[model samples]
Target: MIEFRRNIVAGTAVLVVAAVSGCAPGTGDRAQPATTATGTSMVTSPTAVPGTLVYLDVAAGRPITMTTVTDGAARRTTFGTATRSDEHVLVPSPDATRLAAVESPDPDSVAPGDLVVISAGGARHTVATKVMWGGGSAPVWMPDGQHVIAAVGGQWRVIDVANGAATPYPAGPRPGADGGYLTWSTNGHWRAIGGSTDVTVTAADGTGEVKRSVASLPECREAAGCPTSVQAVSDDGRYVALGHMNSDPSRVTEAHLVLDMRTGGLVNLPPTAPGGSVDRVFFRPDGGMVVRTVTNDGRYTFVLLRADGSTLATLPDTTQQHPSGRNLVTYRP
Candidate 1:
């Protein structure tokens, strides 16, 4: 039921007619414009506030972006043609300093042309060497803004924002999945890879410490090996979100699992209802957990919880707080 980011990151398709070779890693301290023909008009404002939220509105023909500050101010920018909802997107850094986005060559192409780095100062720097086709997860910003973590071609790589060079992650081989796969908690020292049969947690040294079989879970189908798959990890690397294989047409429940990397404990969160299910599971920027669930009636519920699984507040609609613009705190990285 956890909709991991195959195309969860939202953005508009760039309609540039031509493709340009990217600059080298040592491209100097200046903020480089990834595309000279970037179609977006500039909206000069103070640097994006620390708690600013960046999200795309795919409802219109184009993706309209809303960036809202913590103090109740919001700016709206609409990009070109509305792109596929499934494409990868640039996640804001933990500090909100920079973002790693995918820039496309053509307006209608499904594959992204390159990885572009956008700064809070409105600078666009393209990692031209890092072309992405079939992006696995949304680009994740490391604790620092200098690097990003992404899954491309079934492999996870840490990409430098300034240069296009990619470095192999310390994690072991890529795990299997029924559909798009995204690893959670990239900033943490511990990571879990959920396979068709079991879920395995490993340390930075690639040592597997916990292995639990999910093959017989009621939410699993025989067609897909394991029912639960790993999604987002917490900033502290103590928790992981394990998504269920709900995309398959078979009779698998949409429930997902939240794993504790340190204690090796697993909490199987059942679906919210007959017609409802859990959408996203992640630890907030403040180390609290957020579970966005769709009720049986189809209303979106945002449940904020403490690190120890205690409930904080459940906002039926975050829009109540930001009356003027869309509040997106659920999209996966």
Candidate 2:
């Protein structure tokens, strides 16, 4: 299995606690400001916004929660019992109605485990397998939403969510082939595979690859935290989000970065509010990006941003009691 480090930092400015999913509900684009508990304002609507943002609430029984833009309301739903913090949870389907996750009956083992598929109304299907689970390397949903792509014993496999059927998937390389972490876009057309020093953007079929060595950048050489893995990829494979790690091991700092595959340039999102840092960035299916921000006091907030880096809305706060305080599982938009 390809081991991965899941603790990568994401950052951006301002605050709005809301999720992004599906199409805009109303006929016209409306501008509304929702004040968060922190007294910050978030833009709730602007030009066909992606409504519905889903994420995992770890401290709360590890249940999956969905927050919508229209009312800034969140509804919590549990698929199954809680798994370890390291285990994957609530990887949403392409349609955002179903979710894919990994679980182990034997909780202490670090090896691969069974794949679980959870649909709407609390219905679930579990398929026994040895698929490795971790951040950015979790089971990925193909565009069809019925089948899932997973990494098994190092290579990729196409699994039928309806049944336990599986087949070898060679669209991407095996673990030892490049020693890089692998993450695929939901569209199944692009893959971002790389490590702390560099990242490679390529077609799903393994053609037209472009690699940039981040180790050569000033952030890797002179900054406190260096990127450790690729967190999320835009649907078109044009924008890539990176996670950073510091050498001190005692201090954690996240550098909010997005790589423009088209220009080979690195773009940083707006700065975060005082003592807050970006934790994760998930690209919405329709457009824009969902930025997960973390405060020093263990509060979590989700902000929806347009492609131009403007705030669409900010989801409300979700807190984690654990020392790690990283409760976000996945954001399905």
Write down the TM-score of every candidate.
Answer: 0.59, 0.66
lDDT of 1 at 71: 26
lDDT of 2 by residue, 1-333 (tens): 000011111332222211122211111232333243211222346332244544444433554443323234455555554456224344667666777877655544445677878765556687647766543456666667878877666666788898878887644343332233556675566677655677776666665566777776676775553574665676656567876642321112232677755445565554677998887777754446777777777666666775446666775443333354334444444
**Positional deviation of 155 in candidate 2, in angstroms?**
3.0
Model 2, stretches more than 4 Å misplaced? 1-49, 59-73, 85-90, 105-107, 119-124, 134-137, 170-181, 186-188, 217-228, 245-255, 284-287, 298-306, 310-326
lDDT of 2 at 269: 56
lDDT of 2 at 271: 60
Q: Report the C-alpha lDDT of model 1 over 220-298, residue by residue, as the tens digit.
A: 6655444555666654444567765534211121224666443344654434757777766765434445576776554
Model 1 poorest 10 in a row by lDDT: 12-21
Question: After best superposition, candidate 1 residue 299: deviation in angstroms?
Answer: 2.0
**Top TM-score: which candidate number?**
2
